[model samples]
Target chain A: MTDRSRDGLRPSLDQPRRGFMPRFNIALVLPAQLTMMAVVIVPTLIILWLAITDWQPTQAIPWYDATPVWFWNFYDLWYDERFVNAVGRTLFVVGVCVALELGLALGLALLFLDEWPWRRVAVSIIILPMMIIPVDAANAFFMLFNERGPINHMISLVIGAPFEFSWLSHPTWAMAPIMMAEVWQWTPLMFLLVLTGLMNLPQNQVRAAIVLGASPVRIFFKVMLPLLAPVISIALLIRSIETFKIFDPVYILTRGQPGGSTETISMFMYNGAFVYFRMGYIAAAALLVLVVVISVCLVLARPMTKHS
Target chain B: MDRKLELRALRKSFGDVEAVKGIDLALNRGEFLSLLGPSGCGKSTTLSLIAGFLQPDAGEILVDGKVVNRVSPRKRRIGLVFQDYAVFSKLSVRANLSFGLEAQRVPRLERDRAVAEISEKLNLNPILAARGGELNMSEMQRVALARVLVTKPELLLLDEPMSNLDAALRAKLRGELKQIQKELEQTVLYVTHDQVEALSMSDRIAVMRDGEILQDDSTEAIYRRPAERFVAEFIGDPPINMVTCTVTAEGGVVSVSTALHRNLPLGQGEIAPGQYLLAVRPHHFQASREAAAGTVGSEIRLVENFGAEHVLHVSYGDDLVAVVVAPGFAREGERIHLALHAEQAHLFDLESGQVIALQRREAAA
Candidate 1:
């Protein structure tokens, strides 16, 4: 069999093709490459050009004909207290929300490790938040946080008085609803990831620990938690990146209103670009965010892939 | 602490299938007992019940003379080495060894001393810094064993601990494991399907089939006097050969006859036997190059080689019977005389598969 195959291949390899061989493999991928160039590459180049200029869509001149500001937009952005505050607020949100999501997901995933009746149903219900469209989920939270909504009604019932507090309109509490909406929507995704890791864990390791006379808490922290580290790191990485760019909940719930206390980087960029028509200025902010996110992801992803 | 472990009519079921029917067993301190059976014979389930991992539906598990039916696995103080070793893959070997002691809140100095002792005993001192996932199979096995032994568990359960090892490693580890068990005087409940492991290591073995133990006796007795046909068949290496035969009891003289040999006398029994199975171990049949008195002739059909000995498959009346011989003793298609050692044979009733006892005449006479 080996000789026959080798003999069959010898003639084909020993002689060159008489005519040109059409390169069809490159042609097969051309459509996808062209789509990527049109949708992603073209806009990115446009953004780069606009980032160095003072162009606005409302200006009389076309974008390419606009005057170059030559680093003035970046100079203005560095001292822009609103942008700086937004950056700080977005980081804070990512930290608090990802931590909370991980804690909640881990607790929930542990509850799901052992099967009981209706466990599949319970998981489906728990992960229902992940299945809802982000826009629709943000809208749902908008209604839930309303002064006359069920949340206030439940609070009134608990405290034994008719109380209605304006959650979205309060500057100090406005960010709470937005962050809560983000956590509420994406925690199910984190939960699912953690549950998968838990289900796939080496069961005998846990059994060995159990028989070794480790307490339940010790087994959980020393055995299960260390085993779960890779999964937790990945979940935190994904949730942090997604929460850093949080926009829909802010837009639907408060629109960074109540004196911009709830403004995140995505909300600030949105208002600067489409709302205020400062396309050139927001383009600079977008480019800065892109570079920062990519670098941070590269740093985080290397360790993650290595461990997993 | 009179008995290291005892189970009273232990039973467990999963949904509708009863994995372990009612079982009763006891192990004394320093006793090495093996639960020997084929797969799905409830040996592992029995181990789990004793380890407190699975709750028995209907009976009591006593450790050190106290009922522990309501106890959780952690409080049971049982050490288990699983089939996969389960060596805490994320921890270093030292950490894996020290885990149990630390969990019990042992002092750092004492934990270190205990870890060092077991590591030295198991030859795991060299791999102390290696991660559990990084070590080879034998190292992982040593780590798994050393981890539990450091805890000084009340009882130790090993679920086919050597199944993952190669044959050479298994043979080497078997001797090492037996030595360790003897040195420590640890009360162990070993679960395995391999008869060689059970026979070689166990002080006593309980042969199980279909969720019930057929015979619980000393290792030698279980091999010599099996209570049932399954026990006889499941306890030997080349496996016991079952030959169809007729037994007659007339005037206190009982005789059995088979197609290969006729009218071999067995001492008096009240057994009203017709067709029965004569169970003979492979080594019980003697093979000679020449026909001798009371020897029947058979042709060697195949020779299966083991390093120490070869099991020759010989063609009997209408079936093949394996007889163990020395290496290069016989070749294929060669005629040889085979003798039946009646004193060492067992007769099983055809219908019930239960052994029918009879006083036997000494074959030497």
Candidate 2:
């Protein structure tokens, strides 16, 4: 029997129209784009406008009338040594925190990735510090790390003398506490990511490596680490961005103390606008800080191209 | 030196289930054996035991007459090709081939030479630098084989190697694999649920069911002289046509009583006097255009064609049977008698399924 159809059944012209996409395709896309613009783009635009003008919530800069100050605030910041020190401190904190967090995160990720007896317990415990109360509650926890606390008492018992190291008092030692707080708060985040990456790794390759006679150290370094590059980069991106915006523990613990040792750029702006009430200067500094962060983030993000 | 590997009474139980039940088999040097069975029939588990991936509950797995029960898979040196052809996705084809060598800490130059040799053999030289995901399934399979073969193991355990290939490709690969195995002369224990693959590729096929080897024999022997009904039915595509018959032997000429009143001559194998099943292969009967002499059974149904093969469903008393006709032969619902060639027919014991002695049947007759 002869049949007129495309392939077996339907005629070519009678075939259902496939190229016409459903309305929900565009409907699903438009709202997401609009939401991103509303949440991300609008705020960035307002911050950009505030950077150029002498716009303050309390009062506008003098003789400007708030039309546009045209870099006067930035010029004012150019002479401010505290702003300069704040930049240095922010860099110092991000550098120390990122480095320590990465190392600890890698270690913890490795631990959790392994099939250990207390792996689940360690994971849940690591997650506890981040989940409890808030960032300010971190001070209550840090209070346990004090000279008069159980930590110092334990040190005294172990060493036969009470140890004294005022991390909150000394400038260099002060960043240690903030770095510790950041590490405590976010190491779990990196561990979870790296562990996920490790979990998805091809076990056959590892087995093949072992079968071929690669040592454990060689397999881990040459095989496992290279494959886990994507996840490591992702973790770095997230941790660096977050560590740049560090404000909570520094605010509660040091409060930019010991001559601005713990004064992150975020804290500097907070002090400028809220404590010092120099909103115009803070607004200008805020924009400058934003630029510096984006640029540094872009640079930190460069090595990650191997992943994708 | 040719060494024999033996799995002595190998038994493996997983929790409440016994996956491999007291299997005993030996693989001689350069022998290719196929474990043929249905799904969940313990063939893969047996392969795993040989690979040392799974520990057998109560058995000694001996490689070259030495027990390797406690050895890890990496130490066993039994190269396994999984059903999916599990290649390392992260590594290139060259790296995949050399990975096992790298693991062994083989020198770089030696490793490169080994990689070159295997890549040339597998025709994977062009794609040596191609990552696994970038290759097609067949290409990936070749890479996986190269990876396993590069190690030069004593045993190559293939677990349903071609189950994933399409029919045409399966045929091609099976032929290629047979040639390769013959050329390499490596002892291979292949597992497949596909009967065609088992029949075509194996030197001997162990038909498995319910965690036990039902029957094991040469492919041709399994086809012609099946030890059990499971073997008879499993070896054939349309399966052996089974029908009830009254078996009688007199003066060394055994006769089988079918739906027709005439008694037909039974094959040479000794039979006992009793009711029996007349097992006939589909292609054994000759089709006649008109009524043919010596034809016994009555026709019940017929199919004009099935792809390239035609089939006829016939009945004798309460027994239903099938007869496969050549392509372009027979019409639908045609009346025809299927004559049995007694010399080629089989008589199995009703209870034990054992082939009965014909002399005893003759004496009883």
Candidate 3:
């Protein structure tokens, strides 16, 4: 409450106000936001700062030199073919994974548009794989494709012999299994976002389409798909960014097998910074990756951005 | 833009509750017909059935003397203007107008020509480039009409087109709509729950209730000579007041009796010995200028003076009735007498509430 309206007399004796003033005591807002800044914002800023500075937890001093800067780190990343290969591998893996995931998600979203018997059971089963923890669970994929795992054993039983097919030794086949694992774990997220978009679509537009005498297929292509573009791009960007930084599935499932064929850029950065203690190079690499992510996102978001 | 439309015994039911029990009506070419009803009266369902969104349980819908029950809505070639003004939000006014033409695969040259003419007719020239959703309510409504009219449909269906507008815009559009229909000689089927909409603009009105067409006739016939008690009550403003009565046989005249007064002879409805009710419209029941000869007895309960008019709220044995009159009236705790114009009064059967048919001497002669 302000001092001007002390007695609940809203009409002031000396004022003819046309706009608003603070209705409540605003002193309470300051301390509350200060606490959030200390807890959340400060830590986020420190991490971003640490990505640019040459700081290491194992070092005797937080900064190895008086002025901690890494000019050589930025130029050195250009010569690292292994890191570039890792970045290329991450892009390829996430690209194929998000594409297949969106196709399955859109199919499920459309299938669930109309009510049918046992729809709840089918939808629950489709989203079940995503609910499990990815770390302890990426090993489940490891178990499924293991040489003596149940799947190969089951296949051997079907063939009436203990078949010996190389499951995880080939580079070309190595990324395929990793991509499949990523799709299984993340398709449910795309399904959920796309389903929300489909459900919230303006029903009046659909009814107008029907009254205009459009076939169901034409309606899907002309109306539903174009409208669903926002959902697709949003799902693509979020899942791809999340997938590009993917480390757990590749780490636990394939362990960067077939001579680092399945190693993503994040895992490579983790090894560079933590395992080999190359803080300057990893910091420079992380900043470059951030720029790439932002540029990719901006490119994907151009159509949905309103010009006005 | 004009074609004869007829629905033959069309019925629609949802799970056990029938929304449109059975509707049958014929619309001649170039006539404007209004389907009038209260909420939940199945007027919208009847329009949807005619629009081919809902399939009838049993019956045929004929457009231009051909049965088309199986035809899809797009294939039906009918124009519909919805209440919310369903012009495409993504399309400009001109694009919205051209949508129906493009749907029918009109040639590019012909479609553009049709849109240009419709845009001019609806006075949407300045708003040709504006998005449909960005327009105000009145302009949006004009665009909706323009979009439908550009197709040159066989019949035009407007479903409560003005219900969402302000009262002022509704009146203005009502006149403009009627004038346009007259100028084009377009066959129109309009639906509204408002009696004012029906009475002001429609040539013929069909009053519906509980999924059945209670009465269908010309607007004047429906209002002046309401076929049922519900029609008489529902058709007028503030509704007609009804009171139960007993009609006793007298010396060549049947005496109508109520609790407030007794033995008033209204020669219009024949008096049957059974139970009945007397319905008096508020306008028909008036405070006589001077106590001349004969008048029914009523005491004043209250009087309300609006700047231009006064309403008399009177009570007669738990029946609160009102009488609206011009300004310059004051009667409080002062005795007042009321009279009923017998020719204007209606007698209804007490049990069924149906209006009793009156026999005219001119017809007999």
Candidate 4:
């Protein structure tokens, strides 16, 4: 017996002419490349050009006709106390929210590792907050933190008196609700990723540790945590970047009102560009925020990449 | 005498499936015992029970003469080397070795000394600072063994630690492992499916099937005098050949008859005249061209050569029998007469698959 092929290639009566392969490849990728250039690169260049100019929307002059006051917008932003304060506030909020989310997520992930009744149902319910629309969640928090809301009623019941505190009106209290909203919306993501990482860990190592007379706590610290370092770093990096750009909750809850205490950099940029109509200044501020976020992500992602 | 580890009627069931069914085992101090079985035969499950990783459904696991059925794995003082060489990838070899010691609150000086000694003994000094994930397979295995040995637990359990190595590397590590165990005099309960490993390294072997121990005896006894049909077939490479036969009693002597041969006197045995299964190892059958008085004629179907020896597959009626012979014995399609060594042939009860007593003539007689 010999090897046989039923699905063999057949000779065609008319053969098509050969074409240039590289040119065809270029043509195939041209649409996506053009879309990317038009949507991302062109606007970024326009923003860069506007950031160095003293262009005013109130003036009827074309953008190119405006005088290029090189470094003047940046110079103004350098001394702008509100912008500096917004940057600091943004960093503080990002730090608090990311740290809290990571801690809570890790705890929840570890809790979910145990066998319990309705664990799958609980996990599905826990991730529901992440799936809710940010603006709707912000509105829900707005109603829940009102003076006559259930939260205050519960507090009143706990303290044996009628308690009413301005959650969104007070400057110091405003950021707390906004940070809570941020943590609530994103903590589920961290929990999911960290749980996956924990599940994928080498189970044999844990078993070996158990048989070697290491206590449960020692096994967690020595074997599990070190193995989970890369995953935690990645989760932290993603959460930090998202938290640094926090805007929707702050916009809905406080709108940087009652003082500008809860004003994050994104909120400041929005108010500057649309409310204050300082487009050039906001562009410069936005560029600085982007640079800071990118640098922070690079620093945080180093250990993650190394471990992986 | 107090045994190092013992299990009394150990039973574990997962829902409807009984993983380990009422097993009782004991290990003598400084003895190397191997639980030999195919996969899912509950050998590893038995190890896990003794290691306290799994609680038995009913029974007691005693370590050093004390019942530890309720003890946690960490407090049981037993060491287990996993099949995958579970070295912590995030820690260095030195750190991995010192983790248990640190957990036990061993002093830094003593921990260092013990680490150094085990590393030198296992020849892991060169890679002590290397990350566990970076070492090669052999190095990882050595580090895994050293880490467990350094702790010096009362009982050590190995679950096919050499299953993942190349053939040559496995052979080399087998010798090293035996040497290390001997030098340390560690009480080991090794689990493996490979008969060669069990026969070569273990002082005693326990053959398991379907969650029960069929035979537990010295390695030589398990190999030479298998207690059952499963033991006879499962222990040797190319396995033992079996032929259905009938035992007949005449004049207080017992003889066997098969389809190919009749009235063959089996020296002596207290076996009732009934159906039986005769088992003989491939190497015990002698094949020759000259037809002997009591030989069965067979036609060689194929020949498998193995450097120093060759296995001849011969056809007798509708049954194929294998005979292991030295090289240059017989060619394929050759007519040969086969004779069984009466001393090496084993008779098993057909109904129960249990070995029957057989008495053979003395060599002097």
Candidate 5:
């Protein structure tokens, strides 16, 4: 027993290691793990504590010292029309933007399938939008939709009258510019993904279909589309998630103005935390959004991984 | 004698290189014609041109004498089976088989019946619900065939369909495919580089070389009377043995004298005396264990085992020539006697590579 105790450290080191962490190189992942823990895990824990307490940063006390009001923030969120409207509006934006992006991308990708003299040049031009900074693209859109911008000038030229309609201040029409900007800026990425999938497809299958007398339309839907399912699903998942947190164009063009007609979930949280200084309520809303988005992504990813 | 498909001076070029030289070919209804050649021989290019997948630089393609060069592939109504057996991986076997029928807007009941018939014919019932990608290579081949056969196209084009199959599977599929073609009376244009496939399965063989069809004839005729040295060298299993010899034509009797044999009479023809090549198949050279009165003595250099027969590569005056013999007849390094059947041999011009024809008395009789 005395000898065993003396060799304890050596025996422990020789024992088969347990747990997944021991199998990995901790030094290689130390920086990433530490960053995630500091930025994400710590903030999440703090949010869990702050969610139950009506803590405002404007208060003359530390967040930990605030008095807790358990479940009140969630209760208030349930009846808040603005929060409910923002959630619905965000989903609507995601659906519209992702669908539009997919449809436009698919159409554009089909044109580049066959080789031509200037095909590479055309492809480079088409993907140019994706290379620009998102903030710059949003600013460009804001100016394009301005009251006295070239858009109105073109409309005036077509209609033979001055057509300076204020697109941002309009209640219902303001959402158009934001969605268009999102679609225009990101459709190129979706196009490239879909084009890659199309290019790598089994070429003989298409020729076989051609010899089988399948019409072009029939070939596209039945043969090519099914082959593109995995790529399309991945594109949809990524674009939908990115569109759900849309905020840059909204901030640049309208900032959720015109009676808050276009406030998405991210914009709602930003206003609650930074503008209105409701840190506790925003923390609760953020948690809810995070849970919903994660679950939705999981459900969407299940069938894709299974097929692949 | 209905001409089901025909290509008139079909030509195709890829930049500076011509893939398919101006070539003319025709397939009768219900006939199985094989385009046999080595790789880069433009046999596949001809198939593609006929299928409308590729446009010929200058040529005419006709289905039942109706020019189809301007028609779209989908409208041409031709069926093609690719070398890889390109089965639709995402679809089930049944869906793949019925794809053409559905595309042609055949009613649901007719489509199902056609799919059932083809699947039953191809023995694909067990894997009907299986996905195309899930099936093995042979299964994919069957599905690819069934998918096109269900459409009942006027002409079917198969591009090296058996190249992906194993030897045993290939032998079995060859018999099966020939039987199916005969039973259905389906006109087929099969492409292959394998001479065995061409000889065993084809009713007619078109030997191609370097983007040109050298000979298009009945299988027996192509084997027995190859027009070019390339064709004779390509068609036989042991490959025709080529020997340089001197040809002399005198007294209306054309004969060749080689290093081993003297004055071996070929036939009667009008020809100038010059050096020529004497081509003879391995089977035409008779081998004996002991030297005979007319046989030339040689030593066996190598032995190739081919199950039923053994091919002996015997030394023939500083040259090695293959002679097929029964197994156990000879061993490597053993002394042997070989005699040439002169009438069975061919004579080719030294410069032209063209066969020098001779009218033999026995052949004429």
Candidate 6:
């Protein structure tokens, strides 16, 4: 239609000139490619190679004397009850924290949908927890759950008795405080995303549904929920991934105490690498965690991508 | 004789602005009534109030002689087709059609039958398996209509459903809508700002302005016997020509005089002699070449050819009057004589914008 397109009709004009063009493109991209190789690719390959070798950092043996064990570290991890329990506990925490955050955030978002005085101020206050650093948030909760803290004081007043318990010393009860801290720090993100989805819903369709005799509950489940599927899925996926790698709150609140009961996969990996100095085993375990995370992400992102 | 819906002094306001002032209307059973006005004339507000989407501030809405002012939209058996054709994009066409029936807890077999019947009638059976997001605009509109109609609502409210359509598609859908309404004998309340859609489809039309209904009458009477100058000017395509004149009563006859036309006799009516507006439609004025007695002479300033009819904008002294004539009857800069029939002209009070006197045909003859 135009001169350029007419020129494309000829075979000779379609061939690109052989000059410095290809080399120039390579030159432009070389820096980024080299940076990725040095920073990510080389380190990942070394970690992979080390994972299959039997090497002890504590020994004074040279690196060339290390022998290939061929997945003996991975095979030992399957039978390691502590490692297995740590993985299970991490999944449990992720499930409970994500569920609680999603439920509380959905409730808060729905409440903010209505008009009230000081609504903007209230929303700003609610989002403040998300802005605080995670370590600081964990420390704040750590102080709050102490023996003489306000939480114990409120509990004592409610039950008409002074109730006192060492929250970090108990084995099973230690996880509860860490989970509460995680939920409090992250629910606002879900609220912000879901509220945006709620506000952007097609208003005419809602009005039409009402006029066609759909009750409020029906409208929510049938119309609103289906429309919010993509947002809900994405929010849940992000929350699950972050909650699965939870470590700061556990370290601050419990330090994996009470016979390692509150230890997550991240804590186990950290102990293996730094505290126990099992470098080859930790590398093998880290690769396994990466595979698990990728599988979980793929599973969680399926519904969202399908909808879009 | 059966009154299907009635509104008594319905009123609404958003903050300081009164969206719908006190208004009263009665819709008969099986009659297609339209609320016709320009944008922001409260037509859509009235439709919302009737559909139970908004509660009237201080009035009563009666459906089948029962007050439903406190009823929520879900409880009121009313159907509304919005202007945007709000078809649920996530649902299949069949699912969208059966949404209302599903809400009412109709049995699956019966709901399926109803959906099939309505989809067939609306010619949407071919697209029933497709999702609503995949369909074109016309198909979306049909799905919206069928979704509402399947529930067999008592009263149907449509708010300019064809406003988003192209002209050709709109004309076709207009005929189909009218035909479907007639077949079902449904009590319908249609709202539109386009006068042509209102005039062509409505059994009776109510013209509104500034949140108030100025005139309500049959389509024929609204065109030929507009109650006020605003109604006359608003309803016609070329619009009505209005000239300021002074009325003088002499014995038993009343005559109006303007700067360009003198001593134009109007039929007898009890009108106080004062400044008034003389309104006449373009087609009602007679144009000729020869200067007849009692005719105003003017030179044509411009001529617009519109296939079957031509409109000549003629200038007389400082006033311009548009006269509709047959094609090839006049050219630019040609001298033509124009006369107005006494019965075809309307007189309104200049300040109040109300009809002061309308000449009777028999009396004028």
| TM-score for each candidate, following the candidate numbering | 0.93, 0.84, 0.83, 0.92, 0.91, 0.86
DockQ of 3: 0.34
Error of 3 at B1 (Å): 17
Name the candidate, 3 or 5, with the larger DockQ value: 5
lDDT of residue A202 for candidate 3: 69
Best by TM-score: 1
The total number of steric clashes, by the backbone 3 Å criterion, in model 5 comes to 0
The digit string of per-residue lDDT tens for model 4 on A3-39 reads: 2232335433344335785689889999999999999
Off by over 4 Å in 1: A1-28, A147-166, B363-365
Candidate 4 per-residue C-alpha lDDT over B133-174 given as tens digits, one digit per residue, 9 for 90 to 100: 898888888888889999998988999999988999999989
Q: What 10-residue stretch in candidate 3 chain B is worst by lDDT?
A: B356-365
What TM-score, to 2 decimals, does candidate 4 have? Answer: 0.92
Give the runs in model 6 whose Cα sits over 4 Å from its true position: A1-81, A143-167, A278-284, B258-260, B272-275, B289-297, B316-320, B327-336, B363-365
Tens-place lDDT per residue, model 1, B123-150, is 8878999999999999999898999999
- Please, what's the RMSD in Å of model 2? 5.1
Q: Model 5, range A77-193, lDDT digits (tens) per residue?
A: 999999999999988999989999999999999999999899999999999988998888989999999999888989999999989999988999999999999999999999999
Candidate 3: list runs displaced more than 4 Å.
Answer: A1-69, A88-100, A135-173, A221-237, A257-261, A291-308, B1-3, B65-67, B250-255, B259-262, B268-271, B296-311, B314-318, B329-336, B361-365
- Per residue, candidate 6 scores C-alpha lDDT tens digits across A65-115 of 667898899999999998999999999999999999999998899899878
Q: Per-prediction count of colliding residue pairs?
A: 0, 13, 0, 0, 0, 0
Q: Name the docking class for model 6.
A: medium
TM-score of the A chain in model 2: 0.81
Name the weakest run of 10 consecutive residues (lDDT summed) in model 5 chain B: B356-365
- Which tens-of-lDDT digit does each residue in A106-144 have in candidate 2? 777776775889788878888777676556665774695
* Predicted complex 5: DockQ: 0.69
Q: Which stretches of candidate 4 lie over 4 Å from their true place?
A: A1-34, A62-66, A147-164, B259-261, B270-274, B363-365
Report the lDDT tens digits of candidate 6 across residue range B187-276: 899999988889889999999987889998988889877887789889987778888888988775788887677888877777788888
Worst 10 residues of 6 chain A by lDDT: A8-17
Sorted into a CAPRI-style docking class, model 2 comes out as: acceptable
Return the clash pairs for model 5, or none: none
